[model samples]
Target: MTSSRLDGTSALVTGGGSGIGLACARRLAADGADVMICGRTAERLQAAAKELGCRYVVADVVDEDQVAAAVRATAATSPLRAVIHCAGGTTSVGPIPQLDTAAWRDTLELNATGTMLVLKHSARLMARTGGGAFVAISSIASSNTHRWFGAYGVSKAAVDHLVQLGADELGGAGIRVNGIRPGLVRTELVAGITDPGPVLDDYLACMPLDRVGEPEDIAEAARFLAGPESSWITGQVVNVDGGHHLRRGPDFRAVFEPMFGAEALGGVIPEE
Candidate 1:
């Protein structure tokens, strides 16, 4: 029943097995784009692709060889109209003094390097055929940060810059590169950060919307960027953080205050 804005377009989404990536894949498909999804897990990728009426590929973004292959695979059978790079994660969390070098490296590899790989192959393919749209998933963490978010924030910062660089180089080829920086969205990835102490509540207090973002929220933005609606936009990092970045973030403890009750604020941690 939904009208499609991309009836003849095609898109490839990395990390499309779940979370935001899956959401983007579904949205693109709904918009009538021929979608191709890539993930490290074959089963998950296949399932997601089937559910979305899209194609599937198994590849790790951090692997250069695999990245090239993924691009070729997706391009071979589709018109290659757009690309959504969403394969990234935080490898570690903690103060700098306690940060693990390997973990930090892994974070950069997966986020920054991986983004470059996807864009690289996509750009090459798009260049040959004139041009296409490329959108990357960044994070609000890139601008606002805490002690434990160093690696994650830095990696996203790189992604933001990468978008600008892509715009500079690829614009001539008719390609538009942009990014979407989202705040705390409920996803399986967030569930693993138990020590963060209710990440959603921490973000909700200061966010103007007083609510956590949904993957669909980001999907809507990506849809715009991919379609002709945003044809004139490029090299921009759009904040989809429910205005969380507009206001000053609460103190670390204040951020988590919602997790505790009135009694806890008054005097006690409260017994479970």
Candidate 2:
């Protein structure tokens, strides 16, 4: 019989409605895994499921009960072998001092807390099935500081640490936990930016590859960690950033100041 990497196993991808999550789902399904994607938007999930030939659950990761339910639904299909947490984004952008408390809380809740909840429920299910791999979508911003990425950066930093802690805790259970820190990738999130050209230019200037990342770039790394090929790798944060981590990221303050006004940025400027 011809063999595939994830044959006879099922994979779960959060935020699979679009972007990196959807890309990961596609990769996993292509590898012969029965893939299920979950996110808050039912329409997007349905659309993505059809396009990728996978299943989907509409659930909010921040809600523990919903997350648990999503896991249960996935496990009902087959032995869950892989989970990719891609359900997070930054809702706020500005200087640290100017950032609203709600933005900070939302950032942490969605990125950090949501990751923990997914890990918690997915690990439990995996434990019952003799363990699997859990991969969280983090950001290069976690370590690379930029003027307006403070909240987002801090949340991702927490995710990185959580991946390590989870690895340590779940290792004995045969579960491996890891994270992927992606560089600037064009996604719906970035598409929301008022003017992305200058920002894209800034990122390109710093990227050694001279190009921004595609969702597939991160998805491929996620596939490695999720499959048997990386059975020994865990608790690691892989930078699939096209070498952008070696250089500074885009200056959001600079790019948005003209649109939002310098005063809105609270006097923040990129360091020389």
Total colliding residue pairs, candidate 1: 0
Per-candidate TM equals 0.88, 0.93
lDDT tens per residue, model 1, 80-174:
88999989998665545446789999999999999999999999999998689999999988877653454988999999999999999899999
Identify the runs in model 1 with alpha carbons over 4 angstroms from their true place: 1-4, 192-199, 249-272
Candidate 2 ranges beyond 4 A from true positions: 1-4, 192-196, 263-272
Q: Using alpha carbons, what is the TM-score of model 2?
A: 0.93
List of clashing residue pairs for candidate 2: none
Q: Which candidate number would show the highest lDDT if scored against the true structure?
A: 2
What TM-score does prediction 1 earn?
Answer: 0.88
